[model samples]
Target chain A: MTTLVLVSHPQLADSTSQQFLKESLPDDDIIWEHIESLSSLDVAQEQAQLRRADRIILQFPLYWYAAPAGLKQWEDTVLTRTFVYGDHRYPLADKELGIVVTTGMPRQAFQRGGAEGVTLDAALAPLAALAHRAQMRWLPVFPIYQFGYLEEPEKLQLVVDYQRYLTQPQPDSLANRQDWFAQRLDGMVARLAEDQRTTGRLIASVFEQNREQIDQLHDTLAMIKEQDDD
Target chain B: MTEQSQWLSQQIDQLAAQQEKFTDRAFWLALKQVVAEQDRRSEQLGGEVDGRTWRPDRW
Candidate 1:
């Protein structure tokens, strides 16, 4: 799927988390645009980009529990009523709208009784409402809380998690996650060094075997469940 | 973990350790996680199948 990642950080270069995320962006079918970098908003071109993308990711740092001013400006300029729901043509209908929001506060801070006393969903309700009006599928928000404090392991995991949020199919189930990884295994194995190549292929083969085994077992379980229903 | 899964994890760890790039290592390690998920899910499904098949009422 073609994913359009619209990042709205005023000082993109100065933000370490944003820079790290930029470097970790997946290398396929993605169009990354920095909002503040654009001198002028070409409404038609921006609308066309939105039209072309299967998934539209609005990525930004949380500023007072809302997106930065730049994103709001882009929305006002580009998402004209005529293009969105005017003239009865809902061009963005059925498209996926996802959010990648980073916050300085901890994850627990966004709860009802927490320090912030507001959830990410509550903070981003306006965006969700806009998605609703356009008849788009609003994905569950992907929030990165306290990005500065993350250690090596968490950051490493974030690489794949972020990529999946941008590109993988909805629901984020194990089956879909498996398919995502399985699709990339060949390319990953090919990239390994000569000596490591054999081991990579072996691991890939075993992974595939495990996947097939799980599928077969699932089928068997389904059959038994069906019998029990009789 | 099953013997096969244990072996697979070791192979993945070795491959990840050998990778020069951070992203490549991340890919391998993240994949190791999915492999672990696969093992856990397989075990759960296997157990459920066994439990359902041993029904004394049906016998």
Candidate 2:
């Protein structure tokens, strides 16, 4: 199937890692839909692109353990309920989705037991769910790990490596790709969307719980702010 | 479980506040599944994939 890679790297021209990765990907079967070139995309066009592809990959560089702020903004603007959910099926449903993020640290910096001890997966967990809600298949991630370990000249390999990872699918291949955790949403999206019947039970349990807790926190924060105002 | 719930909630709050985005239950449910599967897959294969052998199953 054809793939649409929605790249969201800031200053992609200056990013050697992204450049190398893009260069590595075979032009056939992969369409690099650079969000940068799109400049400012409208939801209609974004939705159209999502509808057109069998797979959609988010390509960007990580900032503070997540995608640049622009990506969060991208999702907020593009993934609205009317087009992404509700009675009308989102353009992303059943379409494979994944990520490729370049970072500026060693892989050891992001993990449960490593230097930073905060897993990249944990950091990007929200994006994972968002992909799921959109009904896209969450493919494996392509993370350019230990980015600080490489010299500028060596970074092209990291980009090329990520491009190669996007070409493949399957749980095992996902784990071994060049950029670990760059793709943080694929597994869940695939599991949830690939099977719809069980999704209901999952929603009631996990989905409802997240909402409840989040609401509680917001309510608490609001009250505290009011107290401070008082 | 309470602590986990609280932490999860906090993350949601941070994202929503910073982004002005609503966190849908559907998104959370979908994300929960992704976390579960990512954990499972890592347990099973421990980071290894043959680049030549992957394909996208129709969305």
Candidate 3:
């Protein structure tokens, strides 16, 4: 089957990191659909690409904890009801949906009780739910963290990690499925399919995996914040 | 027992037992490799999920 990589970066040509990673894709049978100039995005052409591919991959740099404006627009225009989410069903149903999120902060900050005190999983809920609503299964998100400043080796490793994130089996394991509870607001995740719902259970289980570590991390953050108050 | 459930249980047990090793270089590396492998194979099968698969040469 062919893999369709739908990429959008405000200034991809300038992003050496993103540029390098984008070039590492398989050439044959892989559809490379990029939005270099969003001003000329013809809805027809974009939908044609999404309709032809077996997998619809949405990739973007994390802008304010979500997709860039172009990606958001793509999601809005291309994933329309009649064409994608209508009575017959969205075209992307059963298609593997994955997101590659690159961040400058430590990966720990994106998860609950991280040193920075913000969890990525929680921040990405709207995106995940959006995919879930489309009935497009969500593969574990691939994150490139601690990237504000990096050495050559760090950059190479980040690229490799990106590649692996795209190819990995059992992507679910990568997600800290344990926090489905600790972060729960109500019957949110519980509403997913039995198969999908396990995500929360798994996150909760992960929370149990390193109970002490997470708690300690939170405690340290608390202490630091308390000190700052004084 | 269903293989999926059993496999997940085994993994949970393995992770639970290897508590002290969570922060170790070996565990993270192993987990990274596993996630990639799983996601890649699912693509091969054209699973209902949609994801991107890029190779090193492409970059």
Candidate 4:
């Protein structure tokens, strides 16, 4: 899938989280754009990028619970009425809209009883509404809270998690996750050092075996349930 | 966990340790987590199958 990641950080180079994310981007069919970098908005080109992408990610540090002003400006310029249902043709229909939002506060702060007193969903309601109006599928928001405070392990986890958010299939189920990894296993194993290739291949083989075993068990359980139902 | 599953995880961990790149290590380690998940799911599904097989009413 071709994922379009539009990052709207004002000072892209200064934001450590944004820089880390750029480094962690998956090597695949991806298009990365920084909204603030563009001197002028090419409306047709911007719309074409939106049309080309299977999944569109809007990444930005939360500014008072909203995206940066640059993203808002881009929306006003590129997302024209006629292109997004004004002409009765939903160009973005069935495409996925994902948000990768970074917050200064911890995750706990984005709840009714927390310091921020509002959830990410509620804060980003306008974007959600836009997705609805465009008949787009809204992905669950991927929030990076308190990025500066994260230890090494959390950062390590975030690398893959962020990549998956951009490229992995929808629903984020174990099945889809397995499929995602399975698809990449061969390439990962192939990239291993010569001495480590055997071990890498062995590990991959075991993973695939476990995957198949689970599928078999699921099938068996389904059969049993079917029998019981009759 | 099954012996085989444990062995697989150990191999993955060792391979992850050998990788110099943080992201590469993360991928291997993350795959190990999914392997663990697969084992748990297999056990759950196996138990459900066993539970359904011996239902007295069905028999």
Instruction: Estimate TM-scores for all models.
Output: 0.98, 0.54, 0.54, 0.98
| Cα error of candidate 3 at position A35, Å | 2.5
DockQ versus reference, model 3: 0.02
Candidate 4: CAPRI quality band? high
User: Looking at candidate 3, what is the lDDT of residue A129?
Assistant: 87
Sorted into a CAPRI-style docking class, model 3 comes out as incorrect
TM-score of chain B of 3: 0.38
The worst-scoring run of ten residues by lDDT in candidate 3 chain B lies at: B46-55
lDDT of 1 by residue, A140-205 (tens): 999998999999999999999999999899899999999999989999999999989999999988
Winner by DockQ: 1
lDDT of 2 by residue, A1-230 (tens): 67788788768798766666665564347777677676577888777777777877887887877888777788888877787787665667787777777777787788877876787778778888888787677766667765557774345334334544565454544333312323322332343333442443443355444434444544555665575476
Q: How would you encode candidate 4's per-residue C-alpha lDDT over A1-230 as one tens digit per residue?
A: 99999999999999999999999999989999999999999999999999999999999999999999999999999999999999988999999999999999999999999999999999999999999999999999999999999998788889999999999998899999999999999999998999999999888888888888888888888887787677
Tens digit of lDDT per residue, candidate 3, span A46-82? 8877667666567777777777888878777766777
Please give the lDDT score for candidate 3: 0.57
DockQ of each: 0.90, 0.02, 0.02, 0.85
